[model samples]
Target: MCTYITEPVDLEGSAKGARGWQRIERAHVSFDHPQHAPLDHALEIDLIDGSGARVAVELSAASARALIGAMERSLERGEAETGEGAA
Candidate 1:
């Protein structure tokens, strides 16, 4: 249920609706925790590059700043992954 856009929402809704979202395999997530992804405690996301292929993106967002920060972090991680694969 994740969408690639500018930034994360206020995310306050999750708090009020936390009861429902608390259960895994049904709630939205900022990123998939490697360990939890397989367990369904979090949603696993595979990025779509608009070119018709799938890729992985890693990030997390607990706040406004962290959302943006995750993007930077994800960029670094993504680049490193791409570099390693290329080599």
Candidate 2:
């Protein structure tokens, strides 16, 4: 069953697409039929830049949760190393 729910939001980050790495300005998250993922349905995320650059990722629900947690840890470590999280 397709969820057909798309949640889009503005974001700041960098994603590597076909051309190269580009700044991400917006992101669209949805759980629906995937084009390439080897599953009936997957959580799809589309990262888009203001300049029209785009990057897409499709992962299983469990994989998506793991990715989110890993990303949070990675960012926290980077901020800690740079003392950016210090008051």
Candidate 3:
């Protein structure tokens, strides 16, 4: 038998030049409108694993914007699903 439990991690980081890691308090999976920020939209997401190791992920600014939009949409879907279920 195999089982797994995973929780999304809250990651944050700044740009390499004229940029730095942005501290985030929380993170949720919801599809909201994504805002495009400047800077070639280059972004790096860093998170620490259970073993206390730092991990970095490179994401394009465009991709990051898309993700935010997706998250917002997820929230929308969740609301719709729950609303219908309640009714």
Candidate 4:
């Protein structure tokens, strides 16, 4: 079943798509059926640029959790080293 759960986040970064690097301004995160991953449902993340260009990712539940943990750790370490909190 499709949960149809989604969250939109404003972002300021760059994502490399098929056409090369683009300045991403936002992201849409969702949990639903994946278009490519070999799973019934997956965590989907779409990073989008102002011009509508986007880069997409789909990860299984376990992988998603691991990725989140890794991201958190990395961010924390980065902030500690920089002596600054998240912006």
Better of 1 and 4 by lDDT: 4
Steric clash count of candidate 1: 0
Clashes of 3: 14
Residue-level error in angstroms, candidate 4, position 70:
0.4
lDDT string for model 3 (1-87, tens) is 112222355644322322334334332332222234333334544354333343344456578789879988887899888874323
Better-scoring candidate (lDDT), 1 or 3: 3
Root-mean-square deviation of candidate 4:
0.9
Best by lDDT: 4
lDDT of 3 at 17: 23
Best by TM-score: 4
Angstrom error of the Cα, residue 12, model 1: value is 28
Candidate 1 displacement at residue 27 in angstroms: 26
lDDT of 1 by residue, 8-87 (tens): 22221111131333211222224434443343223333333223233333433334357668878887899888874323
Task: Please give the CA lDDT of all the candidate structures.
Answer: 0.38, 0.91, 0.47, 0.95
Which of 1 and 2 is the better model by lDDT? 2
Report residue 64 deviation for candidate 1 (angstroms): 1.6
Q: Which stretches of candidate 3 lie over 4 Å from their true place?
A: 1-41, 83-87
- Looking at candidate 3, the ten consecutive residues that score lowest on lDDT are 25-34
RMSD (Cα, Å) for all candidates, in order, is: 14.6, 2.3, 15.3, 0.9
